[model samples]
Target: MKRILLLAILAGGVVTNGMAQSKGNLNSLGKNDPKAKAILDGVSKKFSQLKSVVANFVLKIEGANNSVTDAKKGTVYLKGAKYKVNLDGQEIISDNKTSWTYAKDANEVTINNVDPNSSTLSPAKLFTNFYDKDYLYRLDGEITEKGKVLQNIEMTPTDKSKNVFKVIVSIDKKNQNISKMKVFEKNGNHYTYEITSFTPNTNVSDATFSFDPKKYPGVEVVDLR
Candidate 1:
């Protein structure tokens, strides 16, 4: 669970050579495809115009042999620098200044201070700002699912020291929103996030981004900061 949470925070947060070759030559060429960038720019623009967003997604993890290892559903609420994520047995809430990582099973919550200006990527940033730098991307064409057209883009990180090597982003062409992201790690593990539902320009209250200790009596609070 810690590993998955870390993956969620890292630069948006790879595949084997054979698997790489199977995908295509986009990453091998190491050039940014203008068409892909344009689409990503459109997505960023659309997201920037919204006041807030609530997105529900599914996190699917796969093993080296392409078998499903584990799957969990999660939801994220975003308002400017503030965001909250609800995942299996855990909730990560941040009000742009402080963050709370709560474990439901342990009835514990860890607190830490956070810099809103930091370049770290939240699940919300993963949709827009993730492609802004250090990546070589190309349009991998399109596919139709559920009667919607989704454009596929293959992205490769220029930095070799990163744990994640590649990320395949699928964009909802018509809506100009991200629909799915398949991330491959050097460990041969695969993590895929599929947006189940997206509601933009939500009227969520600021209080939603904070964890109220009063709501849970006898909960342990660990202040790391």
Candidate 2:
């Protein structure tokens, strides 16, 4: 199965007057702005230069009526293709090879192997040339908040059959790091992921990405990999 946890919470988009209603699928990517590509390229370059990342974020889900339905706070640790996320008593760890999903309530950890060529979009893959394909994007100008400038970019998927119809991404003007991402669904639901804090080149060990059942006295291990 696809990585359910990250896919459910994550994901990404803009100043378009109105979001286009997604219906049938499109085989090819649509319009891609050169300006957006340049800015995105810079974002990718900066992220590639980082040794590691420690970020705290919040996910807010809003209903069709624009009411806040649920919210969650989480932290993500990133080092190359390896990363770990702790959210709502659930831990997802991937060592660039194997993946460990631990549920605190169940006291069980499920294991799976990573597919290197798979275009699975985890938070770790969000920055590394992620916008170049299967997406049509454009620069939506900038926004200023608390004396900080954020560049806004709007994105729509080439495949219209997907549940997510659009995405709006905000990047810090100074650091070029991601500030926030808002994802819109076809069913009048949306998710917002705001990067509360970010630290690059943080010290993290390889062992941090690999969850060990032994560490937990009575945790059960389900090796599906």
Candidate 3:
């Protein structure tokens, strides 16, 4: 269960190109340049038009001296404010109001109330809105990746005390989509999330965002709400 949550949080903390500003929050955005704002807003507008998104990702956790401590691959389903993620032998389902994390090995499911504003990765913040409040952003530079031109943007958290100190997002210039994200933590660790496949407007039922424990026989439910 702990491993599942770690993956989810690591994936969710990633920021895509978007200008979804948090309400009454302008301090962190004061350093944003006009060019950077334009680039991010363009990407956000394009993503906002999608009805749903499905993507596969590769997550890598690096320790000191840039040694990769762990690597995992996962799939994510997103529609509106809801999301479902499958990583390792665990699954995370969120209906935008509540979240369920189920571990196959332990046959246990942990449920909790959803908090979108939490520093941790919440689906609500992951899909549609991010990075206008917590971090001050700027266009670091541009580069080429896999024959595609990508704009690199760097962000620093407003609160210096946060565990995550810096975030860098690599955006696909042609489509304005996030291709990769790197998070630098204060504890000398870093996380990287690379989007391997992205499909927009994928047909999916709302029920996919909710979990049904009955389907899994002998699953123990632990409610933390």
Candidate 4:
């Protein structure tokens, strides 16, 4: 009789384990439900309409070892398909046709044309569209920051040559604006951008996106093209 009782207890244990495993799977499925997808789609649609914007930003860059560096106050001007970032007393300009990085301290500038197919420092890709063909996306969940709820979504690139390993975007639900972005590279490097303010459809002058090297006489221009 003791042998039979021992066998019954072993069988009961196996059944209990199976039920627990099944419940865990169900919970995982719930996290990927349609609610998250709806939130992502709504935010993407809102960003598609942005044509021009001018805003003040405070950029914070963190390294792989969690070392942090902060940039001083800067002004960002964006028009149609061009952008200019004035930071650290230097100006980085992309005129939709050509791009230039002007360094005031070193008195040097690097110039290159915009490569629509390549993913680099092109402001066009950073603000408007993404290379969705080489990446897959999933909505992570909702998070609250600064008393506002945001939809957090994760993106993983399929093409290894893309260099980008993962990307996370936190989009504000109420304003349909992106609050934060984190990019992780395959080399273990990462970049994060936190948006402090956003003003859409602001009228920016065309000269803001133009580059005139003659204005900076001592700066050397390096052409990367």
Candidate 5:
């Protein structure tokens, strides 16, 4: 149970990634080769144009034996630096500064200050700002899956001490959106985040990123800030 809780927190934590300098929020740290830069530029530009985005995703955690240890389905709404994620037993809402994490099973909510530069992989970072300086990326070529052409971009973390060793991103060439992402961790644990559905230019309200305790009855709020 402790392990599961840890994983849940990690999944729900705030992660900072590099948004292109052109987008006015540059935080990337890795050196991208020409080909990688071009491909990432397309992704960066496409997402930067969105007022909001909503996507359904599946998270699979695999063990060392290549067996699935856990799997969960979730939905994410992202706008600017704000995001809200909904899973079966958990929900994370963040407005870029403040973050609220609720675990239904525990009937508890934890609030904290969101450090955008944190080196964790959050859903918000995965979709928009994943390709920046923390990863040295290379284009691994294109492949067709389900009749859609995907450009495979391989990313190696610049920080060797990090638990995550490598990340492979599959981008849809037609839309320049991320089709899937796989993270290889040093502890023999693998996480695969697959976008099952994507909706761009969504009409998400700012209130959606802020948590309302009134809506959740009989829940305890723990302020970690």
Candidate 6:
């Protein structure tokens, strides 16, 4: 079960990018440059238009010793404050009110009612609010991955308690979608999330985020709240 939650933390954290030319060279702009602000403004505007999204991808986790665990062929659903992640046949659901982490192998589930704002794991907070302020974003050089050119941005949070020490987001310039993310935690842990497919503003059902342990009769329920 701890392995599942650890995967959630990595997926929600690590496994969690821009445009233009002449103006395209905004990558060369300094932190205080107005051109940089203009570029980031455009990116932020595009980001604001995304209300909900669904994606299919693989999350690869790497340890300090370089051991890797890959959760292949997974789906992630996101709404305002709710998210459901299914990876390698296991599921984790959170509605900004309650969270359920279910392990298929052990037939056990852990439930916790939490303040959404208190968790760095919240997708809304991770994608929207954190990007709004409290961090410095600078465009890095472009790179080609999976045959697509991506604009890389480095983010460092100003607040210490956020648990994140640094982050890098690779954004697809044409679609303005995030292609990859790498997060470095203060505890010397790091996580990386790469997106293989992304569908924005899809009609994801509310029931997808619902948790009913009774549905799994023999499953053990641990109330962590």
Best candidate (score: TM-score): 3
Candidate 3 off by > 4 Å: 1-30, 116-119, 126-130
Task: Provide the lowest-lDDT 10-residue window in model 1.
Answer: 12-21
lDDT of 2 by residue, 1-225 (tens): 224434433344111211111122234554466676667666666776778888889888899988999988988888887888888888999887888888889999999888766766665454444434456777899999767899888887767797878888887889887788888889998788888989999999999998877898899999997
Task: Write one digit per residue (lDDT tens) for candidate 5, span 23-100.
Answer: 332226434556756766777667667788898888888998889999888888888778787887888888888988
User: Mind giving the per-residue lDDT tens digits that candidate 3 earns over 114-210?
Assistant: 8866766566775545655666677888998899898887877778887778888888988888888888888898888888988999898999999
Global CA lDDT of candidate 5, please?
0.70
lDDT of 1 by residue, 150-194 (tens): 998887766788887888888888988778888899999998888
For candidate 2, list the clashing residue pairs, or say none. 13-167, 13-168, 13-169
Q: lDDT score of model 6?
A: 0.62
Give me the runs in candidate 2 sitting further than 4 Å from their true place. 1-31, 124-131
lDDT of each: 0.71, 0.72, 0.75, 0.59, 0.70, 0.62
Which prediction has the highest lDDT against the true structure?
3
Q: What TM-score, computed on C-alpha atoms, does each candidate reach?
A: 0.84, 0.85, 0.87, 0.72, 0.82, 0.73
Question: Would you list the rank order by TM-score, best first?
Answer: 3, 2, 1, 5, 6, 4
Off by over 4 Å in 4: 1-37, 65-73, 126-130, 223-225
Q: Is candidate 3 or candidate 6 better by TM-score?
A: 3
lDDT of 6 by residue, 1-225 (tens): 333433343232222211111132212344423433444555556655667778876666666554664445678787766788887657888887888888898998989986755534445353444334355556666898878888776666556677777777777777766777776766666567787888878888888887887788898989999
TM-score between candidate 3 and the true structure: 0.87
Runs in model 5 with CA error above 4 Å?
Answer: 1-31, 122-131
Assess candidate 2 and give its lDDT. 0.72
